[model samples]
Target: MADHLPPVAREPAAESGTADEPGVPRPATGDSGLRRTGARGASGPRQAYAAIDLGTNNCRLLIARPAGDSFVVIDAFSRVVRLGEGLAQSGRLSDAAMDRALAALQICADKLRRRNVHLARSVATEACRRASNGAEFIERVRRETGIALNVISAQEEARLAVLGCHILLEQGEGPAVIFDIGGGSTELVLIESGPAVPRILDWQSVPWGVVSLSETCGPEGADATQRAARYQRMRSLVDEAFAPFAERIAPARADPPTAESLRLLGTSGTVTTLASLHLDLPSYDRSAVDGVIVPATAMRAIASRLSGLSLAERREVPCIGRERADLVVAGCAILESILDIWPADRLGVADRGIREGILRSLMATGLRRDGAGALRTGQDAV
Candidate 1:
């Protein structure tokens, strides 16, 4: 498809920032007294922790606290900037695209500052990894926003995604397929069953996604047939690349009568939007859509509906709002193509991914501050 997409125990710290007021106190890790109020009386729950994801298409921020095996979401921000726009053709981040992305990052920086995030990690994915001027852009972002963006390699990207969204596989009947469709590239990781942790047998990253495919196969202001052909072409390319992975997983058998069960888990915008449409929602609701199982038949029907709509028409759909209208269909194509190769009864949707993974890793390493309120300096969280 065309488009892509932490708690601690500590004396909960407080923040003065309000750019994007989070709903709950920043989740704390370890054992600490949770001070809901700020230093000043009347201050509400405010712990300071932040994670930033600068992907091919958007800049997103999440501030939350650790809650048992998972974390509860507190404050969040997401805006599409298409940081990797035209990156495939030029092999560089366009100035206009960089500007668009940086603007969004500015807001993220502001939120981080306001929240006084003690532990923050900001990462850039495929587009930046492939860009000739990505290092320069990173330096510029540091100079302007004081937030450096780490351009992660494909391997790390796959691993982190698995860490964040693996919960979807926990309840599955068998091994699951997880993929992320980004603006400049897409990552596919295969997971096999295990009680301790699902094993990641192999992973691949393709330097193609919505923006690249749209530019490569779609016409400039393409007509219906052109768009359809573009989608088909994109699907074909993905299918071709996916064959080897399919072969590796196929031997697991139609019904493995082992101690483990399996299912399909998906993150990225593609699965989320499909889940949203499965509910025929009037607006996006992560709580309702995420972690919900969408039948394979329903998934196909929704993709067909998206294929029939124009960019403008797609925007009209409650689930495919203006922000994601263009990219969702491309994402749908990739998901559908992947499903065609590997069929499963139901696909589990995960709203959480890299950011959650990052936070979880940090907390596990004791890099996170305790709710009682002291930062534990130690080994690297990564």
Candidate 2:
């Protein structure tokens, strides 16, 4: 199945940070007193917002409330359904994949309803962009689940990805390279520094992603050398596609103007799963993984380890279960190639992405403000 998660029960405490104990929900920042007080016409018990990402491999949901300068996560869900499993070979959306995605969307709708989310945005990524019958499937979702899904463009995808991972830009003399490896495509954006705003100097969306690569070039009963060569060939393709973008950002590399250094910030299934594996955790742990840096060498080492394993052996790795074992290597190859093209001391890991970007944009706009001076839109709100 294409990676999609059908909606499930809301767990408020898991995101709030107070529910550190197993099975308890975390205390969300919405309950914290740190929310900005100056927004105009804003009055409320507290505004609840939601963001949903329907990707090629998974469907994810995150609900949150504004906290200080940043917001705190309140509730979250993610499921892998492989919505783009055969999109590379078939131009049309597969009925089976749509069913999986639609089911997941229903769950998201239920969660949004249960959370009483006042403002929300849900986006469909590469799979939806490429499928010939993608629109029809979207209409079906709205009719069946009462959820509106926006099929975002690749450019918008890169922009939202930046918004989600901008925190990394603040840490160093940064002209950071940000990329997301999705199920059907990969987005790479190179941000160059300005005194006031960092500009995206170059961006590209490569059609090859985990889903496509796995389907197109996966081992599939091949000999060991053949599989290795296929992996290498895929990596070379990614490298070739990335060349133009790299050259465009070449000037920034020679003389990074900012005090903060240029680094890579990755937001995708591949990097996050790798982070989980790095910690050797059975399940994903945001605290242990997010914001951590994996050196380029270490990342290659991890990929090397996985490349050597058989499918079953790869599944034995903590972060990559059977569901992802087949595609993980493809993802790793893409990441490794990107990093090798522009060697960075550290590659930042972000569990957050487009969803967080949407919420940040919404609250900043006071779209959910219920009273005067309560949640007035910020100047930065787009």
User: What are the per-residue Cα lDDT tens digits for candidate 2 across 199-294?
Assistant: 787789888889888887755445667668877888888888888877877776766643236577788878888877766678867656666676
Residues 152-198, candidate 1, lDDT per residue (tens digit)? 77777777787777765534454567887777777777777576556
**Which 10 successive residues of model 2 have the least lDDT summed?**
1-10
Model 2, CA-based lDDT: 0.71
TM-scores of the candidates are 0.80, 0.83
Please, what is the whole-model Cα lDDT of each candidate in the order they appear?
0.67, 0.71
- Residue 172 lDDT, candidate 1, scale 0-100: 48
What is the Å distance of residue 41 in model 1 from its true position? Answer: 24
Ten contiguous residues minimizing lDDT sum, candidate 1: 2-11
Clashes of 2: 38
